[model samples]
Target: MGSINYDDSDVLDVLIIGAGISGINAAYRLHDELPDKKYLILENREQLGGTWDLFKYPGIRSDSDLHTFGYAFKEWTGADIAEGKEILTYLKKVAADNGIEERIRYKTRVNSADWSTEERCWFVSTEQDGQQKQYRSRFLYTCTGYYDYDAALKADIPGIQNFKGKVVHPQFWDLKEDDYRGKRVAVIGSGATAITLIPSMAEVTKDITLVQRSPTYILSLEKYDPIAKVLRAVLPQKMAAFVIRQKNIARIYASYHIFRTFPGVAKKILGRLTSMQLPKDIPLDPHFKPNYNPWDQRLCICPDGDFYKTLREGKAHIATGHIDQVTNNEIILKNGERIPCDIIVTATGLKLHVGGKIATSVDKKLIKASERFVWKGCMIEGLPNYALSIGYTNASWTLGSDCTAQYVVRMIKHMDKYHKSMVVPEPSNRDQLEEGPLLDLTSTYVKKAEKDLPKAATTGPWRMRTNYWYDLVQAKYGGYDELVFQ
Candidate 1:
């Protein structure tokens, strides 16, 4: 592909893509540190709140809490596990409060980004309002996340088209257009989304069955913390909120260490806790038991024990087996059981994608992302003057993103001080480094995209880590010895 130009194109110091949590945090960091730098946010959707706004399915909420998930600069004074709408509203407020809303161009879809070594800038081709346009920026921060919006990752169930009832994924759900009331709904998968949807949708639907290949570790916490309430009642709001967030952060950090280090003990403890949530009548071993240990995969978090309550009340049922085929009015299980269904929801999770489907090249040579190395869990190896905002898998995503945003600001300031036009991270010896999965996860989605995902190093700044305090020290305060500034 050749470079294209637009007459009305205006150059910028930075171009932030996707105005979700990462983009908002990036904007705030840039505004605070480099007030004079010119920047623009190109969002493909017509609105803000990337995941929260896009997934409008029933029982939509954060699997993680607001403290770490929220920005480091702002305090989320609402419930820990906030509803999707509330979270989206919070993101919009953050953007508006920081004066970043005016700088956003909605309905702008980025098709490709090409980096020019001669110009030291990225030429981005985009389609906005059905018009082809181009924009140039010295720095490109991709907050587009790692998922495909138009397509969802679902198991290719045999004979799905023959099903008489409607089949849907959580990504394309429209409640107004299709009603589930008085319907027998079958929700597939056992991820956080399916667990949340089964309970939330069961309240309105006649009977909903959760179909799962295997069970996931389930956990619960109150929507509102009593500790937060007492602290806020006694102390000032900001101080209380800050202390609470810190306390929660510490607890969660310790839990990750414990679960990883002592899987046997952690699994037993998690199983006991999960069993406590259910009533005596409901059997625990068959439905709630998982073969994997705790923290092997993400624990499904339910607020106020709603999912367990739904199961105990007989509003929903659990079916564990593979699908044989989808008939006209039901799904036949491999075990020869036919599950009647009026609607089938394949809450089978999302596929991992990077760069928001942007066809990228450097110096007219196409850049194959899977063949590159990941640096500090954000930037890619051999990619200069650009950073990608990817959050931590274990902890809240914003925690890592916040640190990366600060690092980007720091790099920009460093280049400005040295009068350098470009900065790249070059490992002392790339071939000698040991490599593994970018995201050290065992989930099906991660496994499916293993070939396309970037490689993670065994040690040093090149490795993508998950610890918050450690990442802050390495990314924010660590020296740029590995970075080439010129």
Candidate 2:
């Protein structure tokens, strides 16, 4: 196919926003399944691996095991749970190996995408370094995972600006020269970022205090990928891939079962294991206990109890209290205790935006995402020739996302046979459909948008199932006949 001109007539088969893991995988699947289609992956950043490239704080690693976190087609050859840098490298390798790197347009941010009813195409506008460009495509796939582009920083806290010390947020860490060696530091928030950063920074910092509003449940697990590596070595590549996938699915389901069937037993076991790692007298009550069940929100994971070990060794301290306000040189707690620090790191959670908050319009009528039902968590009701690769909060993100991508490929192939130009979710009776929140409100992202988000049917895998195996079976291999296409 010849390169089309840059005008309105330049039509593409697919236009993917966000060159992150989801977009990358979707592009790979498209290339492998339908080689004739033209696709482009647009990313705002100069590089690939969106979040992994953006976050470079200490002790950055996968919260879930690599067996499940890694790509379905690609086996994770590493021996342990992969770190951020390794994952980035793996992503780059995947792009190179699949020859999909050329399709990516970096430093290009999508501004808006409007569906043109007359043309039956999406008119996409993007800006790159102050210059605006436009493209039209038959399908627009949004893979921008949740999380706003801006880091969540609370720099407006009282006296925070007056502090005559170095201050930073993990999301905006500078890679050039700022060092934390032998300096007193206070890390705020107790989410995965804080849990990972505090213990890792404590090794170099003279003293570290972890300040939190509420306690988060932290669990530790071994990171070895022995079975993954062994299978890759002993069996054929395809067979090894199948074996690893089965093992990972089983492990994921076991954990899910434990959390569902025996909450008390699972909690007790996890708490006991945590207590065994902490200091003898450290209060585990209001400080370490969580109000909700595990996986309701993401359970904080630390490999090998590193955070507890750091606290026990006096290198780190957990301040299980509320922050009254920040003073010039210290953080005052609600109980009136003041902790002095030379540096403060705010590990506050991220704000999630679905489809990167892309503005969509049909026939110049603005389409509100919240008003439409999510079809398989990818395509939306009334939207045609479009799908997203959104992940579940409770499982490895890659697993669900990969499943969604595979489904998209299947749907596209099915469309190819009929010479179809578009696909959309069939309208369902609103009164008959059961409704519930699309995401748990406890999650920082979900809470922010709870008021305006679309409600899902309380039944069906597309509605509420967060399990990996069930989702794979239903989304990847089932329901192609049911989806409406034209």
Candidate 3:
């Protein structure tokens, strides 16, 4: 790729990519802590709130509770569980309230970022509309997330082209033109998208057939206040926020520990609860069962028993079997059953990629991300002045991102104090240690990026722990002194 035009008018202290929650929070922290330093937020989209703005599907609500998701300094005064639009609105408000909206450059996509050892800065190339521009910054932070915005997985079944009806993917939903009202639809996947979309679309569509190879463990929750409301009213905002966050974090961690320590006992308790919600005739054996324990993958959460209620009402049906092939207007199952539909929605998971196609190079030599071990899943070992904001698969993405961002700010502050130009994580024994894949084998993103990416250490949180509290203890407060900076 040719180099973009250089216009180095303003040399920034930090250049953040993707103005989503992570990037925004990072900017906020940097500005708050070090107001003298200059920073810029470059976003690919016309608007902020990366994932929230990208996904406009029906019933697009948060999987986790909102209190933990929002900023620690700013209290989430809205409802407990916020919808997609509400979240987007809140993000915009945050930018506006902080007076950082003007600092963001919209519709500008970063092509590549290269680090120079001599200058100790990053050369960032970005394209806006049809024009290209370049800049240099002391620090670089990526919050692009793992998935591709424009791409969605298409079903690989034979004769998919022969289908006469309109096919859609939730990732690429058309806001105008097409409608699913009063039409028979078949949604594929057992992930969060499929779980949330199936029951919701069933309300408008004539019938919805949920096709899945296996089952996902679903839990029901309600947006109500018995004690939280009383506490919030009685106590101060900061105090209330701290109390609620602590309580929720403890509860979630304890439950997860129980599930991990005693699988059989946890399964029995969870299985009984799930059985009580669903129909007795529905097979709970292998279909609704998982090979791994709960929280291994992510457990799908729903508000109330909407998913089960939809199934019981006969408006929606869950087909737990392998999809053999696509035959014109129907899907043929491996068990010799044909389910006909007018519209097919493939909510089949997302593809995960690190840095969102932004290549990293050191001294003109291309550095493969998969070849490096992640330091707290943010900084790559041996890379200078760069950090990534990736989220937890089990917990809310913002929770992990926020903690990591704070640590990065602190590190930067320390660098400023010591008069250090760059900070890199260099391993002591690069030859003795071997690297492994960053994610589990079952994750679609890991499978896709396995060949080209940096290999993270197989052990520790860099390889495993998806819990927020655990990551907080380890990354934020535990190993700070040990982290080397040069």
Candidate 4:
């Protein structure tokens, strides 16, 4: 990628990538904390909302509750689990509320970024309306998620084209083109997407079948929190929300600890829950039982046993078997059983791409994303004036987003006070232990891209983690003594 030539006048204080949840949060933080700085947001997609806007399937919703997923500055008064459209609306409203919408550039795609040591900034090449353009910025903040937007992680099932019925991935479902009404639908994969799609599709489709080679741990949570409701009614909105949010955060911490501490107890409880949801005749050994401990994969849930109800009502079925092949109107199982269906929804997963697939180089040396370590799970190991936002795997995404955005602002203020132009965190002692995968998740997406993702230092700030509170302390105050600024 060649550089875009322009005069020195064309420079900005900050340039943000992707107008999703994290981008909006970064914009708002910069506006409030560093209002004098110039910033622009470049979003490739036509609209905002990021993940919520992209996924348009019938039952698209967040697995995490709204209380934690909602921004720290904003209190979520809606249902615990909100629909995708609702999340999009919330993001739009946040943008509008903060006056950040006007600074966003829609349909702008970033191709590459190069950092100059002499210039002390980044030169970014982008595409808008098939025309290439360039921009320069002192700081670059990327909130683009760690997944490929153009493709999904689909398995190489034999004869995908031979399936006579319509085939689609839930990530790209469109209301205008496909509808499952009166159709026998077969949704493959047992992850969060499959769990969310099944109960909702059962409403419109004649019958829905979720086929899985293995089982995932599914737990049920209440749709509404009575304590939250009472607090909201009794106290001022912010105070009440603060209390509820703290309680919820504590609950999440306790739950994750419990899952990790007593795998046997957790397994029994989850198994019992699954057995209670199914009919007495249905076997739980292979269909609902998982071979791994809880929290190895994310635990999915729906309000008040709706998923269990859907299964008991016979509107949906769970088939545990490997796929032999897909014929014209049926999916043959390796166990010799065949399922008749009119549609096949590949709810496999996503392709994780670090740095949003942007080609980055420093001083003309290519920056291999996999070669470096994550700096407190936000910045690249040796990169300066750059930060990335990725939320917690165990808790609400916004928790990490809010904390990281604020932390970056604080670092910026610290730099300004000291007349420093650049700051980067380097691992103090990486040779002490072996480098490990950046993420501990066992999900298909994580495993698929483990080799490509960044590594984590076993100790110090470079150690990537998943706990919100632990990360909060680290991001806010830790590593200040170690960071080198010039």
Candidate 5:
């Protein structure tokens, strides 16, 4: 791929941060829809694919099916719950085929961006290969995910420091360097990471234990979708992919709504399904039953019922209780049970960090995102010509992000047609607007970082977004009368 020439004098139309799934989608949209616009993707890492490239944990896969998670422009016929490597490969292929790969500048870390009212452009400072560099752009779009890549949320288990065995966080796991063969492994936390690790490491380790304070709602999904297979065999490839994607999208949207609308019924349905997978000896009262209602937090997905199968086979076990402490060779629980293990995998959670900690300012005045509101769940209030991609918590991330990319493109096109240089969201009714969280998730990581993210509204364009169908329609045809375009 050809490299983008660094020229401080040349002002690009857009400067996108991160080469993750969102950034790639943004680049594709800009190139395909607005071909005349010059944009560049700045990735701090040496490779693209963001999370897919960053996490090398065993049995790492998408919780959401790939049909919805995959790009709308691209058709994915692979397994619904795609593995990490396959997802990375798909991302690379999308970038390559679309000519977006050449426009990406790897190892370029953006530090700060300041908007100049007088110049009507942004001056961005970055560090590449230890050399400070500068660039100018008319608009800035952040696709860096809402998590701190440099650090994982620390596990709070008491006496963890005193444990004389190998301790690992899934975020930083090395399959080759960290060996777990024939050793007893204790995975802490009941989230997606913990469940994924249990099934993947079960065959290698003598026994893997899932140690959690409480149970998380787990759902079993078929690895391969028969509907997709039947459609592919009958319809054309592209048409089949499109239909399958939409079907999955509707399925998830309906499921989420059903779960939220009828919590008791949803719980019973999930419980019955889970009971069929687990062995009768292991009851569903404490270990499998979650105290909270369904969809209170994102449900953990086990592909092909592997998580339960591993448990039924006696290779994986679950222990639900508060951890009292960790001895040199055992994890002591509050219930007076000791779990002997050689390795402790902390699949605790992520630490949310938005905008990659890029210091943003307007006219030399510092802009704090936490103090502002999100406009249309894409742009920040009072921030000119800026957009950020945040995906849906209830469905595939790409569905939300793809809409965001489309929305940004629409905004840019509107600006171009109207000959406007800057566009920012400033509602005249800001004072009367009710404040809410941009992310609706109740997960520990989200709650911990609630104060650090942009606030959401209860109504209008500034309202919190969850439904992709609504967002898709809004992104294409939503009114921008509330925005101040100049």
Candidate 6:
């Protein structure tokens, strides 16, 4: 109930927030590289696997392939794109195998973190077991991710309250309680969640309709990768995983560059591929065709073309238009078209909440993340002994977070070797650098959180390059001249 002191052995060398992918990777790196250092991970949830544990909607799976999404330190043997439960199992195994499970404090919610210049340590206030607790650590790392776990982005649906049928949001879906057997369902939004839910809930429901304001770029890919199978057959498990990971990385990277460089040609090719898999009755114009260029926003991936297959099998339908109103039985489009439904699923986009909604301050002055610049894609400007993991938009999330974890470990080791207590990022000529959004995506979530997220420069270590290969080498051997070691 009272404040804790870092004066003696009670303090930890490193305190990690979250038990998600980034946090797990950081924990592994700390134990592997700095074995002598004492650290602990605080997980707000009772269970591990942050995203996989939170969402329980039907057909919940990783959009990115597991080969790249899984940690580099571990080899993944599951399907390329695995379901939520499978991924959660994998995470649990990783934690147990590495002994990270013992280092975690479950159901611990970090409320605020303050850096004391005099003590050269972080004072973290948390709520655990219905009691306020405090912990001190020399370094603080946040892996709570970029989205709000407590809330999702709210959509403006007119007359939604008037609907007599049950309304549900994918974020708050209950697997055990909710039943949709033989009931007509309407899923709103066309992002990855909506696209996934449509195919997953199609067979169980009588009929499912995908209701979207506009179309998003969608691509069909083989879920069980044939190339990975061949690689594993010829190589050792770890060797094969490494090779497969690099292959997947390069494939996505080259495709992303091609899509950006020649959007017209790329669009034509993608459109043709999507059309080939879709039914003739479902035109490419109104439903499949997107207004934006490929990679402008994340492309919705359907494993083994399941989304398209469901449409062909007459289990699913897509209606693209602005919602005019929602009656008790049907959703009226602005064009006067109507689609009847008994259940409404709002799969609206995620809401970005940086630093896990944990207030951070230095010497009692609040640290505004928006005003700070990202240093080496990990540390924030003027923030001492702190780092947050934000992954790449184009590739696997782990690929980016792994780099951050390693980079953070490197910084920690460097400070130890030099006998320094604080390492702070200070911009060199901040006024001259051209600043822009940290993430290079035009997604709705990114746009809405622009004022809350940190800024990135166009040049130097402050820039956040989307390339994993480049980041891998840079994170290992990058210069730290911009950082002031105290």
Clashing pairs in 6: none
Q: Of models 4 and 6, which has the larger TM-score? A: 6
Candidate 4 local lDDT, residue 356: 76
lDDT of candidates 1 onward, in order: 0.86, 0.78, 0.77, 0.84, 0.90, 0.89
Best-performing candidate as measured by TM-score = 5
TM-score for each model:
0.96, 0.93, 0.93, 0.96, 0.98, 0.97
lDDT of 6 by residue, 1-486 (tens): 112233323789899999988899899998888877888899999988999999999899999989899988888888888999999998999888877888889999999999999999999999999989999999999999889999988889999999998898888896442379889999999999998999889888998999998998888888889989999999988899899988999889999999999999989999999889888799998888888899999888889999999999999999999999999899999988899999999998899876888899998889999899998788999889999898999998888899989898888888888999999999879998899778888887779888889899989888875888888887799778799999
lDDT of 3 by residue, 250-319 (tens): 7666877787789889878878878887776676776577766776667787777778888878888878
Q: Give the TM-score of candidate 3.
A: 0.93
Question: Of the candidates shown, which would achieve the greatest lDDT relative to the real structure?
Answer: 5
Residues 1-486 of candidate 1 have per-residue lDDT tens digits of 111232336788899999888988998899888887888889999998999989989879999889778876888889989999999999999888777887789999999898998999999999999999899999989999888888898778888899988888998986642389889999988999998898888878888998887888888899998888888899887888788888788988899889999999998898898888777876677778888777778888899989998988989888887899889989888989788999999988898998788888887778787998888887888888889988878888888888889989988998899899998778888978898778877888988988997778888878868788887887667788678887
RMSD of each: 3.6, 2.7, 4.1, 3.6, 1.6, 3.1
Task: Give the CA lDDT, 0 to 100, for residue 301 in model 3.
Answer: 76
Candidate 5 wrongly placed segments (more than 4 Å): 1-9, 175-178
Q: Write the per-residue lDDT of candidate 2 for residues 1-486, one digit (tens) a residue.
A: 233223333698889898888888898888887777888888999999988998889878888777678788787767446789998999999998887788888988887888886787999888877889998998899999877776563434556777788888888887332377888888888898988988788878888888887888888766666677788889998788778877877877788668868888777877887778888767787668877777677788888778888888988988877788887889998888787998888887776667776778777787888877777777877778888777877777888788788888888877778888778886446567777777754855567766566556676533854777777777667875335767
Any idea what lDDT model 4 has?
Answer: 0.84
Positional deviation of residue 475's Cα in model 3 after best superposition, in angstroms: 5.3
- Candidate 5 C-alpha lDDT tens digits along 403-453: 889999998999889999999889889899999988887888889999999
Backbone steric clashes in candidate 6, count = 0
Better of 3 and 4 by lDDT: 4
Candidate 2 local distance difference test against the native: 0.78
